[model samples]
Target chain A: MKTLVWVEHDNSAMADATLAAVTAAGKLGEVHLLVAGSGCRAVAEQAAQIAGVGKVHLADNAAYANALAENVAPLVVDLMSHHDAFVAPATSHGKNITPRVAALLDVMQISDILSVEGEKTFTRPTYAGNAIATVESTDAKLVITVRGTAFDKAETTGGSATIEDVSGAGDAGLSSFVGAEIAKNERPELTSAKIIVSGGRALKDSETFQQVIMPLADKLGAGVGASRAAVDAGYVPNDYQVGQTGKIVAPEVYIAIGISGAIQHLAGMKDSKTIIAINKDEDAPIFQVADIGLVGDLFKIVPELTEKL
Target chain B: MKALVPVKRVIDYNVKPRVKADGTGVDLANVKMSMNPFDEIAVEEAIRLKESGAVTEIIAISVGPAKAQETLRTALAMGADSAILVETDDEVEPLAVAKILKAAAAEVQPGLIILGKQAIDDDSNQTGQMLAALMNLPQGTFASKVVVEGDSVTVTREVDGGLETVKLSLPAIVTTDLRLNEPRYASLPNIMKAKKKPLDVKTPADYGVDITPRIKTLKVAEPPVRQAGIKVADVDELVAKLKNMGVA
Candidate 1:
């Protein structure tokens, strides 16, 4: 079987998620990386060096600058005839593009796949991570979005693969990029961070959330996350959400302050190396998975902890 | 301009589904069912658009078993002008649902089509984009905020890093995000009024669509259970443990 993995990049380098997807793609068969963007030759070169890749397909065009699914879906479709499996990291870009490719192929998309039982069979979580379902595809071609945390990142450099430039993947003049408001990250990105400090609904308001959460994150030099409840309560931006519907992170040390640990929230961060949970309720479900569970008021404990750190 | 909103019936968000003894699937029998939370947001957004006069009508549609009519009724009570049911018991994949919805959109000539980012049951997260692809229309997915003007719509989408605003021409599709809006509860009067609202039932056959499953469920199982870890008495103990791990 042959596989094509979408290499998500910022024109300069690839996202770690893409490397993780490569690890997954390598599990199936011969892996080919597709680099789609303007001025992506640099990204293409880096992708070509990935250990498992057999070849790199560069769909270089100005239309792909934003990695807009509208434009890149057609590019993936154009190459669909050549590969038996198509894979991408389950990032915002992957979630946006892979479904369109699957739909255009008239196949059911196997999304957020956790494990590859076979070339056509895979495991994924449903019911907001409460249960796992193993599904098999009979479709002639497979399109999958892989959960990056479930797989290790493939080696960045090894055997050199040949790069080919393929064009004429027509512009999809449907939607245009207006703008984006990205987090001004002074610390590392939450998903890739070594340490993460997260708050939950009990943080109350945005002011309190920042006042209580940010100082600890600064002291620990950690990325901050919020449970979906906190994001919904307007205590944090939607990007800060860490739950079934939000960014999944697997950090070395995860500290949860005032979090009740809904199953959905656990789906995102339970894979961390070590977890410390602090909440007033001794029975908070977060303690079930925490290495250290402290039953205390976060208002009292967090400030004291921050001063000590 | 008419707004087309596709709703779905699913296990309620609050319910913890139980995997069957044989691990075939989650047992749906006697489970509490409700309109998918994301679809509720979609319906609420369409109603808001109608109230703002940006949309002249709001049409709610669902493709499922007869019980799905109850879901549509809820949408009607929430302020949809009418409803359509593509009644089917066959498990229709998201591709087929998108095709069925595309046919409905063709008949309605809706200027805007709204749907949930993903149904809670299948979690495919495909219908809106698939419908957009099939119709050859623009799509703004995971939309937290939507604004409309003549022949143009702008959607603020919730992405991984932050918010991204995209501009799409009218006759497009927008998928609702959790932050779109807090859905309104149906009032007593509206619930009564909804029963009288126009509801048309059809089938996938009427739309010339085939409800086929391309994927097969090989097995169903529970996610790996994490063992309950030890609880420390205080911060000093916690820090001491972290220090031993050398990751602090």
Candidate 2:
């Protein structure tokens, strides 16, 4: 079986999520990476080095500069004739584009698979991680999105894959990119961060959420996350949210401060390797899953912990 | 311009779903059902557009069991002008749902089609995009903000890193994200008024679409349970435990 994995990148370096997706694709069959972007020969070179990649298909065109689904989905669907399955990291770009490819291919897509059970079956979370469903696809050509946290990252180097330039499936002329307001942060991206410091509504407001969570996150060299309550309360931007409806992170060490740990919130972070909760409420649900629970005031405890660390 | 907003009736967001012992599926015999929260945001956004005078009418639609009419009534109560219920008993996957919506859009000829990014039950996050694909329309998924001008719509999307703004020609598809807007609750009088609104019932056969399940569920089970660990006495002890575990 030949599997084509879409490489997520910024026209230069490949996103870490793609490496994890490569690992998932390796389990299915020989992996071929598709680097579809403008001026992205650097990204294609990077994709060619990941371990287990057999070939890298490069589609360099101005129409793909923004990775718009209208433009990229046709490109992927056009290439589906040569492959059996299509795999992509379940990032925003992947989620936005893969379904279009699936619809065009007249196939059902399996979204956010946690494990590859067999050639056609997989396990995925349902009802916001409250239940796990094992589903087997009957589609002749499979399209799948892999959750990065579920698989270990493939080695970045030590592979020599042949690069083949593929023609771009020209612009679809449906949508056009206007502008983007991407937050510039020095901290690691939340999904790829090894450690995460998450705050909750109890942080009071945006000012306090930052003052308390930022120092500790910087101390631990971790990504900053917020419970849905915090994001809803205007304590932080929506991008900082970490929950079922928000970004899902499974870091090595997760520190929850002032988080009440709703089922939706736990759905995102319960998979972390180690959880530490510090909330004044002794009976908060977060403590149930926390590897280490500290019952106290977060305002004081968080600062003190940051100081000590 | 007419706006079509798709709503779904799923298990309430607050209710924790329990997998059946026989591993068939989630037990929903007597579960509390409500409109999917994301769809509520979509409905709210459409109402806001109508209030702003950009949308002349708002029509809500849903494809589910007959009980889904209650979900549409809720949308009507919230401010939709009318509704359509594509009644079905079989589980409709995203592709089929998109196809049904595409057929419905042809009959309705709405200027905008807005829906939830994903339903809470399946969480597939595919319908709106697939609908856009089948209909050959522009799509804006995970929309946090939407602005409709004369012949175009601008949508601000909630992407992984931050926000991305895109411009699409009118008669486009926009899916709601969490940060879109807080949905409004229906007042008692509005609930009564919703009963008098127009509701058209149709089926998959009416749209010439086959609503069959392409995926077979072998089993459904609970996620792995996480065991709670010991509570530390103070911050000092917490730091010491982390060091011992080599977490820092």
Candidate 3:
């Protein structure tokens, strides 16, 4: 059986997680890397260097520039007929398109897989990683979305594979990218950062948020985060929210500032190696899970801590 | 134009779920079951789209055991015009649920389908896109805003680093994100009226879609518990401990 792994890239550069997806696909069968996007020659060339890959297929087109599922779905469906399984990184786009491909093939999909036990069985988290469930899919064709953090990226051998410019299979139709409003921050991304500084509703407002969270993140060279309560209160953007419904982060060091931890919030960050909680309320839920707890007013304590650092 | 919403019944978000003492699975014997919080957002968005005059009707659906009708009823009380129950006694995997929904959509033929980004129980945010793929339609996921105009729907989604907006033609699927909108509580009068709203229940077999799960679950285990730590008096002491632990 041959596994078709989708390589996700920025059109100019490949996503680091795609390497992890390629490594996970190696466990099932012989792997073929599929690079789909305009100006993806370098990505296909990079995929060919992964140690276990058998071949590389490039479907570069102008229609793929925006990468709406409308265009990518048909291409995957077209390619899937020749393979026994399909795999993609469990990133936002991968989560969006992989299942669609599975539905197109009339087979079941196993998503957010953390481990592959055998050729047909896998383990994944349930209830926001609170519990683990092992599942086996018996269909002849399998589709899975691999958790990038769970697998190591395969080493690159620096080889170039055969590149093909497959024609666009479907119309781009009406979709177009209008504009984007990205949060500009000097800190690293929350997912990959070694340290994270998160605030909660106790921050009061966005203007006041910079006082404690910013300097502390600067001290630790960490990413900034917010509880859903803080985000809902307009203290930060939705992307900054860390909770069951928001992003899952497993940083090395995590600091909670003025956040009364909710279970949903803890579910996302409890995996951090070291946790520090700063709050006035001694009974705050965050202290229960934190490795270090400081009971005091953050307004008074944070400035001193930032200065001391 | 019409809208279709799919809801799932999951462990109530407020409850701290516990594994069975026997290590069989989560203890559901007396646990509270409610509509997945994200699905509530989806239902709320569909109703808002209808109230904005873009959609003519709204249909809510759930595919699970008979008890899932309560989840659909919650949708009706919140403002869905009708409901359909795809009754099944077996555990429905994400793919099977998507297939059954595809069958349901083939019957309803709505202009748009809305679902929560993921069901909290399984956290598999795949069904919406799967249904879209099965129906050969466009999809906009993790959408905070969905605007329907003419034959196209513009959806604003929460992507990494920031927000990205995509426009899809009619008959598309949109999965709701957390900031989409705060769902309203069902009023007593609305609840009373919802009791009279039509809810059609049918088995998955009726639609020729198999509800059997292809995946078998071997075990369910809780994450290792985190040990409680000490409370520090001041920043100096905390940093001292951190330095000693090689974390500073």
Candidate 4:
């Protein structure tokens, strides 16, 4: 049986998360990374470098760059018969297309999977991050979206696989990328980061936010995050917002400052290996789940802590 | 312009869902169901758009068992002009729901379709995009603000790294975020009025849409517990513990 891992990219360059998905797909069967995009030969070459990959199937085209399920779903559906299962990182684009492809194939799609065992069973989180559940996908064709943060990224070696071009689907014009303004980030992607520093509304304003949160994250080489309240207040961007409605992140060490720990916010980060909460309120809900709770005002604590680090 | 908003019935957000004793799924037996909080925001945005006169009609759609009608009525009571219930007892995956909505969108032919970015119960954040994909329409996901100008609409979207704006012509799909808008409570008079509004009942078959579980759930188990570490005072102790754990 062959397992296909979807590779995302700018068509010429492979995304780090896509490589991680290929590394994860290796556990199930001979991994074949599906590089879909316009001029995707580079993506195919990079995917081939991952140790466990057996082949690189390149579906190169302009339509792949502005991937809408309309164009991508049919292609995956057409190729489904050749692969026993499919996996992709649980990013926004992957989440949008994978389920539709699964539905088109009339099979189950297990999403946000964290671990895999054998060909049928996988483990994933539930109730936000409150509980973990093991699931078995007995279907002949299993479709899934793996949480990119859960696995190690694949490293490059000096070998290339045969690049095969595939064609079957065309854009149905469901949606088009009019334009995209990528957020500039100097640090690693939040989901892929090993360290993360987050702040809540208690930071007061953007200036204070920059003073306290940004430097902490920078010192720790961590991604910066904000609570929904902080984001809504315009202290940070929506992408920086971490909660049930925002990004789900799990890092090696998560440091939360001034967050009162709403269940919604906790749902996003409770999976971290270690949680450290800094809040003035001893009764703050975040302390209940934090591996280390510092009972002090973040205003004073953050500045002092930053100096030490 | 007419607008359509899709709603999902889910376990009340305030009521924490629990895995069942048998481990089949979250225990929903006798659980209080409500309009997903995010969907409520979508309804609020749709109604606000209609009230602003940019829209002339507001129709709400929900795909689930008959009980989902209650959620639809809530939208109606909050000022939706009409409601459509696509009844299905099985777990209708997000993609199938999007397909069903695509057919419903064809039938309604609304100028705009709004949905919550994600359903808290399943956290599948796919319907709005899938509906757009299935219908071959433009979409803006995780929209924090939506503005309509002439024949085009601009949506401010929240992405992983920051905020971005996307523009599309009319007949676009917009998914709501938590901060989109605060929903209003239905007044008693409006609740009574909702009973008189038209609520069309239908099924996936009516729209020629199939409700299939694309992803099989093999098992549902609890997430691993995090072992508690000792509390540390001062930076030295904190560093010592982190170093001991090899995490610093």
Best by DockQ: 2
Over the stretch A157-201, how does candidate 1's per-residue lDDT look in tens digits?
A: 885999999985557888889999977878778878889999999
State iRMS for model 1.
1.4
Q: Pairs clashing in candidate 1?
A: none
Better of 1 and 3 by DockQ: 1
Which candidate gets the maximum TM-score versus the true structure?
Answer: 2
User: What are the candidates' individual DockQ scores?
Assistant: 0.75, 0.86, 0.69, 0.43
Alpha-carbon TM-score of each model against the true structure: 0.97, 0.99, 0.94, 0.90
lDDT of 4 by residue, A1-309 (tens): 688888877667777778668767878887887887776677787778777677888787677775655677788877878998888888767876786677666565687878887678888776665556776765678888888767877766754666777886666555455566678789878777888899999999998999899887887889888888898888986778777767778888999898998878988898788899888898888888899878887888888777766
Provide backbone clash counts, one per model.
0, 0, 0, 19
Summing lDDT over every window of 10 consecutive residues in candidate 1 chain B, give the lowest-scoring window: B239-248
Off by over 4 Å in 1: none
DockQ of 4: 0.43
lDDT of 2 by residue, B31-86 (tens): 99999999999999999999999999999999999999999999999999999999
Q: What C-alpha lDDT does candidate 1 achieve relative to the native structure? A: 0.90
| Clash pairs, model 3 backbone | none
CA-lDDT, candidates in order = 0.90, 0.94, 0.85, 0.80
Taken in order, the candidates have interface RMSDs of 1.4, 0.8, 1.7, 3.0
Ranking by lDDT: 2, 1, 3, 4
Model 3 Cα displacement at B142 (Å)?
A: 0.7
